[model samples]
Target: MAEKHFKYVIVGGGVAAGYAAREFSKLGVNPGELAIISKESVAPYERPALSKGYLFPEGSARLPGFHVCVGSGGERLLPEWYTDKGISLILSTEIVKADLASKTLTSAADETFKYETLIIATGSTVFKLSDFGVEGADAKNIFYLREIDDADKLVEAIKEKRNGKAVVVGGGYIGLELSAALRINNFDVSMVFPEPWCMPRLFTAGIAAFYEDFYTNKGVNIIKGTVASGFGTNANGEVTDVKLKDGRVLDADIVVVGVGAKPLTTLFKGQLEEDKGGIKTDSSFKTSIPDVYAVGDVATFPLKLYNDIRRVEHVDHARKSAEQAVKAIIASEQGQSIEEYDYLPYFYSRAFDLSWQFYGDNVGDCIIFGDCSPASATHKFGAYWVKDGKVVGAFLESGSPEENQAIAKVARVQPPAGSLDQLLNEGLAFASKI
Candidate 1:
């Protein structure tokens, strides 16, 4: 086995790893002292682009363009950027074993890596239909999107099954986005989910209604209160139909599964303190082990705004948390201290011509406002979550940049929401005033 050592090592080359590398460079990291081990052949790019613009029928997003920092409206960092910074990009390397006690990681190729400091940013993996014993789920053309390779395979399927029918199994972020992408590719699309409405976790029924209606208007079929029980494959072993639990079947040339995802923390299981199905970390993203940290989808850290401990899986948290962890690391080296990671939960999604942003926790009474009619010329509307008479969360659809900023502020400040009727009448004005 070949043995190498790095002063600092990041064990995943996804959004958090890329952003952490950038933070290291910004903080004057020494050349050759840092290494990022990634299973991906390419350097980290924006993962969200995979399900959105990457599958577009025209002028889709491509690598080098959607790379880290760019996704957060900063300079794009290419693979060469790592070389120029003297940060080792150990691409196409999967660490099969992580021994935190010895500060060593062994790759599948039997390469041993010793690190003085390690950052775990393995992100998450998608749930597959086969995991639930859905028969014939492994047939060709049945897909899940989590990595660039997965997106590439999906792109190939779109080309191969042009103008064919697609069934999206899940009504959450992936399902909604995939359905839109398939529809954009001019494929007949149907969405199936067991939820009463799409995005049941975040969007209120009123909020989901507009999107469900909008998707319906785009000629996409929406099947609710059911799940994909099984799959039917043709002689060529390609997915031809999706059998629902509700005794319905839909034709599908390609079946895309977007059910959900779990954090990728298997390698460090039982070795690290865990909470909420992720590695537990402090506000600085420091894990239980010394000189070890976890970020992105795998770190269940403190949410200062909520006065609680939680894990956020979105890109914004990924970028911000990585930066926070790196900053904490550098500060500790200098015998200096910085503020805790104070984060306000923010989530957003875009598909077709509509974009929506949500800020803060979504629990509490929801106040729906503005024109949410799917047929309206402009689907400008929002929802507010008021808890204990204060606006704890805000959701806005088709909001301008300024309007979005206002809503973010509202969520952070958490201004007292007067009356439900007042909030409904004030609408965007409520956020703007804050």
Candidate 2:
């Protein structure tokens, strides 16, 4: 087998790997000392755009436009950036076997690489209907958006099936964003989920109500309390319809599934300590194995704010955790100490003209406030989650820059809420006062 060696190796070229590379550059990286291995042909770009701007019927986002760090208001790191920094990017190379004992990774092509330190940011894989034994789930034109190739396939389908009937499976961020994208492209879009409301994991019924009504107004159908049980295909094996658990069938020229994601931890399952289906790591993102760190969706680290261990799949956390892990690695190498990671959970989604931001733990009693009416001019609305008489979480839609920051502060501080009614009445003002 061909052999190579590096001081550091990042095993995934996604948001986390990109940010970690940037951090290493900032801290100082010697040429030929660092390398990134990825199965993708291109360097890391904004994955979220695959469902949003990349699907736009016009002027869609493309590579170099939404590269890593750009989402966080930092400079875009193009492939040339890696070349300029002398950081090797081994794209389109899948490391099939990893031997932690020898700190070696073997790619499918029989190429072997040895690393002094390793950062596993393999990210998450999209859950598929086929995984659940749904018949006809592998039919053509049925796409799952996780990588650029998947997004490219979906875009091609959108163009080939213009004004076609599209069925979106799942009600989380992917379903909502893709439904909106299909609608904008003149496709008859319908969303299906096994919940009463969309984004059940984060949005309360009231928040979901606003979005569902808004989507309906935009001519997108919302089918809740049911799921796509199977699929129907034409003679050519292209998806033509979706069969729901409720014994209902809907015509579908194209299907998009985003039921959920599973962390890509199978390779290290027996080698690393895991929690909640992810590789367990400390605040420094150091895995159980020495010199092995895990970040992004694959790392379930401590959430200091909640005093709990959680794995955050959002891009914000992906970037922050990668930076933190790289920083920790640098500190350890220099025999210096750094502060433990203290993260406040954050999640957000955008579709059509609506955008919502949430911070802190979602646990506790929720109180909806502000003008959440769909017909409202400003379309401003928010919700607060109180736990043990303290405001532990906050969510706001159509909030201004300052307003969103204020709500995040309220979640971090978790001020004692005297009365639910009083807090509801105060609304955004409550966060502003804090």
Candidate 3:
């Protein structure tokens, strides 16, 4: 078996891995000291783009164009960048075994890699209907968007099934984005979800109503309060229809499922402490084991802002947590100290001409403000989550750059909302003043 060693190793080449590598480079590294092992052949690019700009009908984003850091307005680290920095890029290699005690990883190809320090950034895996034993879930033309390969397959399917019928099974971010993309590709799209409204976990009914109306106006069918129970397949094993639990059958040339995702921590099961189906970590992103850290979607770290241990599965957290983990690692080696990560949860999504930014905890009584009417020309609106008389969270659709920053600041500061009516009336101005 082949064997290798590195002083620092990062597992999983998603957004977190890419950012961690950048932070390591900034801290200073020696030749052959750092290695990144990933199941994907390509280095980390913006994963979120797979469902956004990557699906654009024209001028779509392509690799090397949307690599990590580029999404955050930083330098794009091409493959050559790894070589120049003397960092090993072990691509298309899946680590089947992780021995945290020995600091060794065994790849599927029987290669063993040892590291002095390890960063686990395996990210998350898309939830598949087949996992729940849904009939005909494995039929062809049924897709799930999570990785680049999945996006490529969807793009190919879109080209092959142009102007065909598509049934998206979920009303989450992926469903909303994919439905928009399918529509852009000239496909008749129908969205299905079991939730009462789209993005129910974060978006309030008032906020969701605006998006729902906008989607309806765009010729997309929204089916809620029910779910796809099964799929009908043709003789060629391609999906032709989606059978809903509510006794409805929708003709479909393609089906896309985006129910949710779970942290990809199966490889390290029983080897580390887990919380909320993710690896438990401290504020510094340090896992239970020494010399090992976890970040991104896989890390359930302490949320200092909310006084809770939370796992944020958003791109913003992925990037920021990765940087914090690397900084903590480098600082410890140099006998230095850094501040604990005090992150205010941030999440956003873009579909068609509408965009929204959210920050802080989305718990408590939500107060919707601004103009959310679908027919309104401005289409601008926002909501504030108040808890214990403080504005704990903020959400704004169609917010300007400065306004979004102000909302984020409001979430972090959690200013007192002396009067709900006054705050509602003030709206964006309340956050702006803070």
Worst 10-residue lDDT window for candidate 1 reads 125-134
lDDT of 1 at 398: 94
Against the correct fold, how does model 3 do in TM-score? 0.99
Deviation (Å) of 372 in candidate 3:
0.6
Candidate 1: RMSD to truth: 0.7
* Ten-residue stretch with the least lDDT total in model 2: 344-353
Report the error of model 3 at residue 252, Å. 0.6
lDDT of 1 by residue, 241-305 (tens): 99999999999999999989999999999999999999999999999998999999999998988
The lDDT, on a scale of 0 to 1, for candidate 2 is 0.94
- Per-residue lDDT of 138 in model 2: 92
Candidate 2: tens digits of C-alpha lDDT, residues 1-434: 66999999999999999999999999999989999999999999888889889999899999889999899899999999999998999999999999999999999998999999999999999898999999899999999999999999999999899999999999999999999999999999999999889989998887889999999999999999998888999899999999999999999999999899999998887999999989999999999999999999999999887788998998999999999999999999999978999998888888889888999888889999999888888899999999999999999999999999999999999999989999889999999999
